[model samples]
Target: MKLKKNITLGLFISASVTALAWQQSGKPESFAVNGNLSGFNDSIVYLTYGTFDDTKIDSAKVTDGKFTFKGRVEEPVQGMLFSRDYKLRLDLFVDKGAVEVRGATDNLKVAGSAIVNDYALFNQEIMANRKWVNNIFTEAWNAKQSGDTARARLLEADGNKWYAYEYEIRKNYIRQHPSSPISARELLMYVNNKTLDECRPMYEALDAKVKASLQGQELTRRMELLSKIKTGNKALSFAQTAVDGQTITLNTYKGKYVLLEFWASWCGPCRAENPNLRKQMDIFGSKGFNVLGVSLDKTRDPWIKAIEKDGLTWTQVSDLKGWNNEIAVAYGVKAVPANFLIDPSGTIIAQDLRGEALNQKLKEIFK
Candidate 1:
């Protein structure tokens, strides 16, 4: 799922983009949600992500365990109601509104009324969070203005506290919504900025949890591994089946310098790179250098056709698993036109080699 983030603490609300609302989209501005929520009027309902303001509550009256929200917006508006920690969930995507929430709160017992009448208000409330964060910095700024060194330091401490709080909140959101791409990215940003303490148990725990959850998610896992691979010195091993139906292991090329080439049948860039690779292969074939081409094609016909058309004379191997190929997973290859050049000792020497640079390297080593 594509995830988007529209708010940041460092930015003012006026700079924030308005969230898309279902009520404004001409779909349906009205919704009746019924479940088991008690207290208040059963007709009362709460709304969030409805307005330009930050407060989550819109408008509602409870009645017969049912509540309704009436507002309109443009297309692609999403809504949901959940009991703490998402124990009970009701989520919907509306191009227009007109949504019904019969089973949303069916089993929850909630007191008090909820309403999100103005989209602007909901946005404002969300901005209020940022304002709270800014207050920490504001205090520091005020201290500096007053020329109080001790107060400035204290306020700076407060600002760091706010950063930690925001980081933790984003972390918890990622934990609860393991599939939320936005939360995952925000957490990664914190990690990259070194704002999240690497030595903290919480940091390690969250990393382990996310990695475990994303284990089989090809794209996410590949992106993550690709990020690490650029900085790592370890050799990667993978197994795939050859067109002849023989299983091939990457380690089989252990004693030789290997060029792990990732490509596809439909990729013009890859096709363009093929001749250069073949030239290098020709030049280095008698040397220790070898080529192992892995195609990302899903079909055998195009894969084989491309090999012939491109004249890629090398040890071609693939499982015919296409994009889901296990070798691709093991190597963290997310895109075609990518590669890794490894030395005879099995340490990666370079990646994404192309054009004359590729030939230049081979010449240096083998000539």
Candidate 2:
């Protein structure tokens, strides 16, 4: 499965020029941002506002160690500011009002908005915890390279512990601050990691306003889609272009036990699992077992190379859109090396089977 990536926190500040008409609860008619960066002089800073699916982006040039952006937003929305090189990023909750961003480029301090402050506080804790986790992983890697298996395992365990601790902190924050916009954002993080049964209570506990926000709406959509793909539900039907430039659909393999696999060329764990998966396919291929590989690769070359190198003879398909791959999104696949094992009649019998578990499951099913 794909590990979580670093989150970019983009921020912006502006001076009010003219008021634009918009209304949000307890917010102003117009919003202004004033940003001061210590080391970023005469550089361009870009600002983007809204959710992942819908966003408005604008850029301003830094002059005299500061930059400004003024606009009107209907409600408080997620906003990001990043430098041209993308080395600096600040994320905040943006609404119509006088918002101020100041401090070192790497450690921005946001003020003048309650939601923004709430997000900042929450983001700080997450970033700190993530840094610690990264350090642990780094040490683990070093230990592995030096052939210190015991130290590496200990460090890996520590990393996982910290990761779970961070998740709990986020969960608790959401539970404690149901009204804060950050709570909705935090809850969205668990969409892929937690099941519907585990997440429904937290989602229902959110404030009505928070639930109606953009991130909340996205979470709701994910939940609705996930509900249809539970263990007992039939696998979602989808069509994608195969590596040979032909169209393929899930129904094409209806008569066999199919493992609908989501993977990517760049995913290390996916590459590592390919050999084992290939072995399983060999033992079961003649017995009506098949694999439908759906790649999340953004480009064609590496995908082709990986397949050849791994000896993956199964049917492969992709739209070459990376994480936004059409089939991947349809299946609600948040990570690579994820799969659903479907029976001959197209019912999902099992999911996320790997290595010996996969081998054992197939033996039990066909024996």
Candidate 3:
């Protein structure tokens, strides 16, 4: 009982320290970005709103290889450091103060401990893991470019190794920073990935008084998505109006092979793949193969026009909600040209088929 009490007390102290650090926020902050530039003098930096949007350079600087950012950022804004079209890296989390980076950082080495407040120690762990992920991403990209397909596959087996790693870090961080919404959300996101059987006691830990107190807006949505995916409970069957004004549910084509395609009207890759898809459709459309396109678009005119322009005569459907569509949330669709090919019985057999490989698959299945 004494050891248990000591553990509980220690946790309380850690949570209190985190809360105090974050609560005393709302002060002006600055960041000093320093690094080496081979020869480039003028570099523009930008913050991307979403993954697939135009880059807007809110801050401009001339680099003698080192630059400083001295400004105040509002809470919940994740800091992104960039140089021209080279790479955009998630540098640090700004709640209401200045955090600094003191070295050259691509997407991989962005999380170092140069300029951070004394309390959280987020910069250290973030940097360590960022380096690991950067190594993985670089290795994967290089292998793929070098035509080393097997090597790339091994390096990039899971696209989400960082998320899972963050879970463990956040779990330990939370014991010392219970009042931190950021840490709490991070923990919940990781827990949500686990089985309900695994997370049951963790949820139960916050059963009554604590659950209501932990309010995380962004964290809440992420947690919900993770929960849904873990459970495999279909929120609603994929339903949309066909181009011919007919209703279609993804479930309607359940017994046959189906590909759930998330794409957009303005996407060049999706347009380029249309011809290959058309050929595949011609061969396999009658052989228990179908495509259900979910357009990540806001307007109907361009969406319809693109379908006609690409000669995509498949059953295209969307709620016309663009990125905010609930279906995108339900399936965890982050980027465009994403696809999942379900087998005849509706299990995900393959994904992201394009180019000659797609043609090869059609030949194998249809022959």
Count clashes in each candidate, considering only residues at least 3 apart in sequence or on different chains.
51, 15, 4
Candidates ranked, most accurate by lDDT first: 2, 3, 1
TM-score per model over all chains: 0.46, 0.78, 0.54
Q: Model 1 misses residue 61 by how many Å?
A: 33
Q: What C-alpha lDDT, on a 0 to 100 scale, does residue 125 get in candidate 2?
A: 68
Instruction: Write one digit per residue (lDDT tens) for candidate 3, span 224-325.
Output: 665554423433366677667787876778788777788899999888888877877788888878888889988999999999888888888777899876
Per-residue alpha-carbon lDDT of model 1 for 215-293, expressed as tens digits? 2132244345655555236567777777677777767888888888888899899998888788877878888888888
**How much is 113 displaced in model 3, in angstroms?**
11
Winner of 2 and 3 under TM-score = 2
Q: In terms of TM-score, which candidate is strongest? A: 2
Best by lDDT: 2
Candidate with the larger lDDT of 1 and 2:
2
What's model 1's lDDT at 234? 58
Please report how far candidate 3 places residue 175 from its true position, in Å.
Answer: 8.2
